[model samples]
Target: MAVNEIRLSRLLRTSKMDDSENTTSFDDRSEAYSEVSARDCLAEGIIGLLLPTVEQIDERVKSTRISQLELRQHIDTLAEDLRALSEKQQIPYDLDSYVKKLVNAKRRVVLVNSILQNTQERLNRINQSITRENERRTALLEPQVSTPSEGQ
Candidate 1:
């Protein structure tokens, strides 16, 4: 059995040598193996490069969500501030309406001023006319009052 095993080992070694000697295009096969290995290495390197970018994109997305939440909170705070300011200033809720109301109030003030000026002018004219009429009446009565001595 030992002799057979030795013979088998010798046979295997000789067969391998024979196969190597008989193989054609050995360089071509080696070149093909090297090309496949190089391609595998390049693929692994490309995947390595892409993995960090994917992770960075994930991080940015998470940060964007946090930023959006902060923006929402800021907006809510601004709205509350606006409400408080409106209450403090006795302003209307809608800005457009408040502006309109102010404009209308100004117009009304202008109109009332004009009316008051007109009424004042009319009163002054009437008072002047009354003064003139009183002076004319006094002039007419002075002669009648003076003639009372002629009858005596």
Candidate 2:
């Protein structure tokens, strides 16, 4: 059995030595054992190229999520700071005007996100807001079911 295996390996090696380029071409069936398929090679190349794109997308997503969270936190801090400012009568921020601006800004966010589905989290935020609005509407429709505008 060992002798047979060695003999077969020698024969295969010799066949490979005689046919280099011809063996590499796809049309040759005898070379199938030694050659790689075009599709497999192409897939490997495509995946190699796509790795960076996928990694970039993932990084962008992580950064966007971090920024979004920071923005919301900053908005909360603004509200608190505004309250403190108003108490001191400094009037740096007009609460009514600032709130009105943010409210409309929220609406614009929704509008832009609704039209642009490719904006993933940007769209997700709008969808979440819309869902909350729907929940509020449903609760309002039923006075005692859950009560509209419940606390977070």
Best-fitting candidate, measured by lDDT?
Answer: 1
Give candidate 2 misplaced runs (Cα > 4 Å). Answer: 1-36, 87-94, 103-152
TM-score of 2: 0.44
Tens-place lDDT digits, model 2, residues 19-76: 4456445335435523423443454466557555655665666666566556656666
Number of the top candidate by TM-score?
A: 2
User: Over the stretch 60-111, how does candidate 1's per-residue lDDT look in tens digits?
Assistant: 5556545555655564565566566777775456654554555565556456
Weakest 10 consecutive residues of candidate 2 by summed lDDT: 143-152
What is the clash tally of candidate 2? Answer: 0
Give candidate 1's whole-model lDDT: 0.52
Residue 87, model 2: lDDT of 76
All predictions: root-mean-square deviation over Cα? 54.2, 22.3
